[model samples]
Target: MKSSNLLGYAMALIGASFFSLKAVLVKLAYLPSEGANVVLAQNELEPITLLALRMGFSVPAYILIGFWAWRKLADKPSFLPVVQAFALGILGYYLCALLDFTGLLYITAQLERILLFTYPIFVVIIGTMFFGGKITRWSVLAILLAYAGIGVIFAGGEIATGANVMLGSVLIIFTAFLFAMFQLFAKGLINQMGSWVFTCTAMTGAAVSILLHFTISASMGEGVAASLDLPPRVIFIGAAIAFFSTIIPSFLVNIAIDKIGSQTTAVLAMIGPITTIIAAIILLGEPFGWVDALGTAITISGIALYTFFERRSQPIRAIPLKT
Candidate 1:
């Protein structure tokens, strides 16, 4: 590989590593503790509250990014892409993020990462179902592989019997589906407005949506002020999640895509679940059973296979083999 291609690979792996830390940090934030410290002994924080904090910390960056990108354009900005980006932002980041964050409260971080990583499969399924996309034999095999992996994971432990875990799993699955839908809807917009611009603007919209949602929910009744007034430690964790997990990884993944191509960056991101599992084990004292190992291995293998075949079946874009 060329030097730039090597850089892209490095960036992808680093970004995946950072992204994997998100769930771990969010899991940490749910506890009441001092700065940068998490105490799992007591689970005191709510998911929406954590989500709102993340958005609150990250919103200014998104707004600045969007405006900076806006000002850089030689021609006046086209209104269509901005409008689409904001709408998609609400759908994906605002709604899906809320669900994902809430789901983490009930499920293990390991399971949450694995489930969330299945958004690409969801994208393909949604494409075949609603759009004119073809479903190949490999696609069928891919679907089977994914569900089988999930089944193994489910059978491995209490996720099968625990009602709360099952509900969280369902919510996360929906989060993945919603994100896939956002990807489908914004495909053209990405090509049109460029990745950074579209991403920043959409995320800005999501941030605004989250703030409004939090304010409204806070006004609705009791326990509102209590939840909103989180401790300094929780807020610190939220900032960590925002910058290290969300904003930085988001941009790095895009840069990696630009350098080495999206398919390659995505394939490399198979590291996400493994890293999350390790992080959860080390950081949160989560169990690491043989079943977890087997299930995660199968899950990653299936996703890699699915990505490979899908790439083969689709027409090649002009993405250079080397940057």
Candidate 2:
């Protein structure tokens, strides 16, 4: 492969690895620390509170980057596209993140990552149903394979027995749908304003929305203030989520797409679920039985097949950078 392609692949791999860490970190943040007499243990921090922290630390960087991109623009984009980008950002990041974080409370991080990884299948389904896109036989087969993997996992009985696992799985499935919609709708805006500018703008919008959410919840006496008074280790984990998972991967994936095309970048991103599985096992002591292994393999293979066939039939388009 060319040097650019090689670099792009490297970026994608690294970005996916970083992105995979988000689930593990969130899980870590949820676990109560043993014998730590801190003001607030990890379990005390709610999803909204954690989301607020993640966005709070990351937004300033996004604003600075957006401003830089805006300054570098040869021509100023219209206000309408900017507004639309903001709305899409709320849908994609703010709402999607809220649901994801909440779902993680009820499910294992490994399962959460696997479910989220199925977003592409939702993309294909949504595209066919609403966007006048045609579904070939390969698409149908891909869908079956992906869902079959999910079914296999459910069949394992371990996940089924977990309290609210179904609820968590449903929430994540919806999150996947919203993310797919964001990917489809945000393409035009990304074209209108360049990728970096569009991304930063969207992320800033998400950050603002999350802060507002936290503010509202705090006013309602949800212990939001107490959650913010985190221990050093939790604070560090939050920062890692913001910088390592959200900001860095966002830029890396974008750069990868620019270099090697979204199709290739996406293929490289298959590393994400695998990374999450390993991290969950090592960090969270999550079980990874044969059933989990088989399901994950099936799900990934299905998505990969779908991507390959989708690229063959359609022209390459930009993959939306997800936080």
Give a tens-digit lDDT track for model 1, residues 167-201: 88999999888888888788778788888888898
Candidate 2 local Cα displacement, residue 163, angstroms? 1.5
Q: Pick the TM-score winner.
A: 2
Worst 10 residues of 1 by lDDT: 314-323
Q: How accurate is candidate 2 locally (lDDT)?
A: 0.85
TM-score of 1: 0.91
Query: Would you estimate the TM-scores of all the predictions?
Result: 0.91, 0.95
- What C-alpha lDDT values do all the predictions have? 0.78, 0.85
